[model samples]
Target chain A: MKRKLTIFKIGGRVLEDEQALGAFLKAFSAWPELKLLVHGGGKKATQIADQLGFTPRMIEGRRITDEPALEVALMVYGGLYNKKIVALLQGLGVNAVGLSGADAGLILAQKRPAQTIDFGLVGDVVKIDSLRVHWFLETDLTPVFCALTHDGRGQMLNTNADTIATQLAISMSAVFPTELIFCFEKPGVLAQAQDESSVIPQLNAALYERYRQQKVITDGMIPKLDNAFDALRKGVQKVRITHFNQLKKGTHITLE
Target chain B: MKRKLTIFKIGGRVLEDEQALGAFLKAFSAWPELKLLVHGGGKKATQIADQLGFTPRMIEGRRITDEPALEVALMVYGGLYNKKIVALLQGLGVNAVGLSGADAGLILAQKRPAQTIDFGLVGDVVKIDSLRVHWFLETDLTPVFCALTHDGRGQMLNTNADTIATQLAISMSAVFPTELIFCFEKPGVLAQAQDESSVIPQLNAALYERYRQQKVITDGMIPKLDNAFDALRKGVQKVRITHFNQLKKGTHITLE
Candidate 1:
């Protein structure tokens, strides 16, 4: 049997709520296997940007990581948010270390060039240094990664947490059977929007495509599901979209 | 022969100057030995404090790390400055990993108790996890530490860079022949107040005390020298105070 590596990505909603974050930490620390945690920047970055007199600009749901916004992201995501999660996990007796992608050259990224939009310092993942991460795992430490990467040429780049989680799962799945979980407020993808109880039990590529064509899973969720299906196709054992409270029970997405 | 470990600590003057920092990084990367870098937070923290609408409070040249000040420290020291150094080192082909004391449980600290002045969120080093650091050293990775520690109970603490360097040197010297170097603008401990050419070549405990009494070395140099001698007495092979440009030629301090 292959060793299991679980990668949990907690979204902004849970990160913004103190009680929920604390509860999630408790639950997360209770697991006795090898795991990694990826956290997204919450309202803190926007608040800091507002205080710094720059209104944060977002294009379609993604942040435009301009110079000032990149600094704010570095401070909030890499400093405040990442350290907070590591400390809380420490208090829970989980030896967690915080990391930006620059640390240990864990992830090498390329600046997203001007395709249709100039995303400034935003980066797309180019390579994942799985050996060092595996070393960290073997050392009995849980790595809590912030949504940041580096361009290898002395630049820190803001990355999306969901993409990072999916990419990490794809890479680590080659070494260990990897399961990726994306946690948010909702229990899972709903059959009908705003209907809490109508959670989809399973999602596959064909059904996901059908739902997309029927406008069932729309807007922000489309990209998230696309990334998850990509992970599924890339040898990740499974990907789950669920609430923080129901991390183990959610809409499990698979190729089969 | 035991392996040689040289830990260089760069102070504010070099950090604040882009050209000097770049030059130092180039020189530092040229060295083909085991090394680590500890960086001090320069005026960046004070600028951040001012921007955040608070006058930075300092007593006897030490920052009073209250809650807001600690947040600023975390952002400046652990976030911007640490990542910048790591990225720059990475660019120079040095695999540098940035760490706060919290990372990998590197340095466990105790909150400084109320002694005369209640410095909030300030930590005194209690233990240094030399084994994990030795693991890094053996793995051929240079650890660049920021001036931040954690209480191991979910609180980040602002610490002094010189003390951190000294403590690390003392702890690691038992395993490796460790040399500690503190870098600043001046060539070394100056014989006169303003004479840059009058660099003191050697400093012993007795000479340091005599110079202090004669008012040749006063103000900020006092605590730095104190930490240096403390490291020497605690088994660090040697300690030097020098300019970044003259890292190899500096005022060597020893207990003898």
Candidate 2:
């Protein structure tokens, strides 16, 4: 039997609220297994960019991470938000270390090539130095990662937090029984979209495809589910999409 | 013989200039002994505070870190500058990890009590977790620390980078033969403040006192020398004040 490792990915909304984030962290600290946190940049980045007089560029609703935008992300995500979370966790008696993928080359990425739309400094995950991560875990330290990676050639790249969590889950599963949890504002993948209570209790690959065909799961959610299924296929023992408060009560993604 | 460890503390001026910082990091990376870095928040913090509409409060030439200022410090120092340095070092083939005193509780501090003038969230170093730092060194990870510490009760406090470097040197010296270097823009402590070339090759307690009596070594240089001497008395093997480029050609401090 392998050691159990639980990974949680929190979106930007929960981070923006002090009380909500504090409550969530309180719960996280009490978790009885090896855990890691990956967080997304909140609206604070956009606000800071505006203050700096840099207009954000977007193509087809996807953020375009130009040089200035990347700096905003670096400051808000990696600096302010990450450190705040680490301090809160420390106060809660959890030994937490904040990290960016560039630290110690923990995550190496390849810059996305410009095609129809060039994502300026965006990167796709190439490899994870799992051994180094394992060292942190074995040393009784919890890692809190922000949505930033590096090219290993001295450039920091903006990365997706959900994708990072999936990749980490897939990679660490080789050594431990890894479970990935995607925490958002919603209760779960709502079956009725309008009704928050109509969450699909158990979502398998077939059900996920059916929901996609039925247009129940579309847009941003498609990629999230795809990443979840990909993690399941790539040896992750379990994956779930749920609300930050209702951690155990969410849509559990299964291979079946 | 104890293994040698070199620690460098760089002030805001070097950090504010990209080219100068790049040059400094190039020299630092080529150093053969085990090493660490501590960095100060440059003018960027004040620039950010102004943009955010917060007036920086200072007393007796010391900046006071109110809540807003503390947030700015967290964003600029812990986030933007620290990550940038980590990525730059990674590019230079050094496995660098960015850190704050909060991360892993590596440095514990006490928030200064409010007296005549409340320094707001500023903290003074109380303890250094030397064993944990040694783990990073043993793991071959170079720590790049920003001037921030936590109260262990969840509050992050602004700190002085030079002081943190001195504390780290004093603590780590027990385990390794540690040397502390304070890198600034000047060549060295000048005998004539107007003459750049009149670098004091070596400084001792006696000469330092004489310079103080003559009022040549006044103001900022006084506290800096006091910290250096304190480290030497505590156990640090050697301490120097120099320009970032002229690491070997600085005013070496001596106890005699």
Please report the candidate that would top TM-score against the real structure. 2
Residue pairs clashing, model 2: none
Query: Candidate 1: deviation at residue B100, Å?
Result: 0.6
State the displacement of the C-alpha of residue B103, model 1, in Å, after optimal TM-score superposition: 0.7
Tens digit per residue, CA lDDT, model 1, A1-256: 6579999999888888889999999999997778999999888888777877877777876568888898888888888778778877887888899998899899899999977678889899999999889999989999999999999998889999999999999999998989999998999998898998999999888898898899999988998898999998899988999999987898999787
Candidate 2 lands at a TM-score of 0.98
Per-residue lDDT of A1-256 in model 2, one digit per residue for the tens?
5579999999889999888898889889998889999999979999999988889999998889999999889889988999999999999999999999999899999899999989889999999998888889988899999999999989999999999999999999987899999999998898888899899999999988998999989887899999999999999999999999988889999999
lDDT of 1: 0.89
Write the residue-wise lDDT of candidate 1 on B120-216 in tens digits. Answer: 8989999999999999889978999999999888888888999999999999998899999999988999989799999999999999999999999
DockQ metric for all predictions: 0.71, 0.86
Q: Candidate 1, which segments miss by more than 4 Å at Cα?
A: A57-62, B57-62
**Model 1: DockQ vs. true structure:** 0.71
